[model samples]
Target: MRKAVSVLLAILLAVTGCAGPAERQDLAHVSYLTSFNTFGRDAYVYVAQEKGFFASRGIDVEITPGTGSVDVLKLVAAGRADFGVADFTATAITLAKERLPVTTIAAIHQKSLAAIVTLEGSGISKPADMVGRKIGDQPGSTNQVMFPVYAKAAGIDAGKVEFVPSAPPALPQLLAAGQVDGIGQFVVGTPLIEAAAKGRKAVVLPYGDLVPDLYGNALVVSKEFQGKAPDKVRSFTDALLEGLEYAITHPDEVGPILKKYQPTQDATVASAEVALMAPYVRPSGYSGRVGGMTEERVEKIIRTLVEARAIPDGVVLRPGDLATFG
Candidate 1:
């Protein structure tokens, strides 16, 4: 009887092993978080969620609303959340301070969507003409900081332009009211929609256009979590790659997807956003695949942040700071 019982226990263990992680009692429970506004590339999470991609991959993804990208990273690093998406600026600053050892696993957009936008009717046809104009923007967001960086590239004096801090919602009001001349926008978010809807013609100043290189948003994991759950990590990325392919091939379908979650997103604007984001979505490649990061590209972004004083000296980390699956 003793031998028989022992044999049965061994069989059960083997069954558990074959069942894989999903059937395990202590399966990894993933909690994902992202800021509310920066939801273009990030919204692919919803695509995976709604289309059953995460379920297919054995990931239990729970999303939490974020106040902003910078805050989202802080929560993830604190172990309050599993993972989050954020721009390179926030991660680099924290990494420079060595405050949190978060590593960026995958870069979603090869180039930054950060842009300088103005109406065509403003008579601000070129980047240089931005001087002395009233620019509607949040006081200390990425725009306020990077505004000068791009302005100088266009030979425009950054200080000459006046910045009026406006909430994302208020931007349209300010522009329509003719209170502010122009506002900066990401290719995915409010600015693009407003441009298309209200005939808010904008001169898009892609960060890549000026710098020929930039690092923007990415999926980041805590150093500790990444070390422990390499398999789950890979699974998460594989699923996102699948969703990205869907988005690229079915741009028409994305508007419906966006409308489902954010019903406020105009289908017309959403369609335009889908078009704008195609280059970043990588029709064939994704964060899980290779060529996502080049050696020179990493160096260029790191060096720019360092020069901007966004990072400080003494931390040994560089652009290759994260674990690369491909």
Candidate 2:
């Protein structure tokens, strides 16, 4: 009986040994900042975390909520966060205006989300309809700042529109109350604005209609961090893109995932927003792999900004200086 038991033990040990030990995982901890508050659009990070994509890549990511894209870019440039999601146009404008030690690693939304939003039946249907109308404008929002450029592309007189200065939160309320005809806003904010308007439908005229080449959000990292840990940067980008793909494909699941991380976020609204943003994230006719950008397209974007005077005249900004999906 003793010999038989010994043989059984040896067999069990052999079976276990054949599988070998688990792969050595040395996790690298990193911080990631979203472009804005814990909205549904930003829920992809949570999805990535829940799916173990980061873990599989030997990364432990800490997610933080950001105020806005410009603010997120500043924090990332200052090394306050290892990586951040921000608007590519905002990044380019800021870079042109002031030198920051940051570079975009991947493109998230291929087109700008900026738009002039209003409630349906406001009698504003097109860009030309905005002339002589009152638009609630947030002081430094990208939508407001780029209005003149949009105005030019749409062939509307910028001076004709009346821009009413208002705080970001007040704009939606102002629009809902019939205090303003329109508001400078992002198309993604439709769900929230419609909620604020008490079920009133939103009419969005996306700037992408005229500014077709403009990019929306991008994955950013400080130049210092990228220089020091290129491999980690690549791994993190891959995992994040994977999460984005999953979130877009399964938008209904994103709401619950976002609610898990941000209890204040409305799950229904979050899901709706993800569904709305999916098209912009992976627009039709874009042949490159997800998160990829070409130098020629980047140059076209720069030229568009320059032509619109969004970027200062004669300010040299090469594609390589702004982004490299390498």
Candidate 3:
């Protein structure tokens, strides 16, 4: 009788596909950092949390907003966060070269959205025209850090242009009010700029057009975290990839999810921001896989950074050294 009852319990556990009590208690706790606040730009992370994907994978993810891409990398490297989203160019060229001990696990934006924006009637119609213009941007903004590379590729002397630093929220307003000739902003910020412009039209010169093969944001993990918790890293990245795929297919459904996290975010604007970011999230000429990086792309970025003097020429980085895939 005892043997029969034990056999019955084992069969029931197998049929139900349940884990043992010990397995149930071993969920991994992960801390994730975003490059910026909870906006439409961070739709994937919001969706992942709202939909229970992270929980389903046994990862308790704590997502935090960041000041900027560089800050995200710093936080992860310093062990404040287990993983983070940051600009690939900055990570590869600046942070990696400085030996910050962070490795990119996935490339999120296959193409860069960084741009130089001006009013439609402004004389800065082309990249060459930006040589003598005064551009306003927040200190250490992505555009400011990358503008030299864009200028070098466009054959413009970066030294000729003057950069006026302002608070981030005031940058678009400075351009709209004619306090500055142009602003350095992301193409995804078009809606915000339009809203700030009130009625004026804006002209955007995308950096991708000038600098070929320029990459964008990526998911990064500190070397310590990667070594200490390889399985947890894989689970977190897989869940994020799933979230990104879902958000891409259900663009109409992400705004409300994002609004849940950022109450002040406009649903319509959030949806528009997601749409603007769609192409960059998975560019047509991409390597035909989600979150995949190639040696060619990394090499081009390093070469461009060298030409722009963003890093010393002697600095060398290999793709395998800075990236990993599971």
lDDT for 179 in candidate 3 is: 93
Clashes of each: 0, 0, 0
Tens digits of per-residue lDDT, candidate 3, 73-178, equal 7788899999998778767665645688889988888888788999888898898898888999766667777877888888889889899987766777899899
lDDT of predicted model 2: 0.86
Winner by TM-score: 3
The clash number for model 3 is 0
Candidate 1 — which pairs collide? none
lDDT of 3 at 70: 73
TM-score of 2: 0.85
Model 1: CA > 4 A from native: 1-28, 35-41, 65-67, 156-162, 189-192, 195-197, 283-291, 307-317, 322-326
Candidate 3 has an lDDT of 0.81
lDDT of 1 by residue, 30-139 (tens): 98876435345456667777787877877878776554445667778888888877665546665566567577777666666676666667777777777778888765
lDDT of each: 0.66, 0.86, 0.81
Stretches of candidate 2 exceeding 4 Å from the true structure:
1-26, 131-139, 157-171
Of 1 and 2, the candidate ahead on lDDT is 2
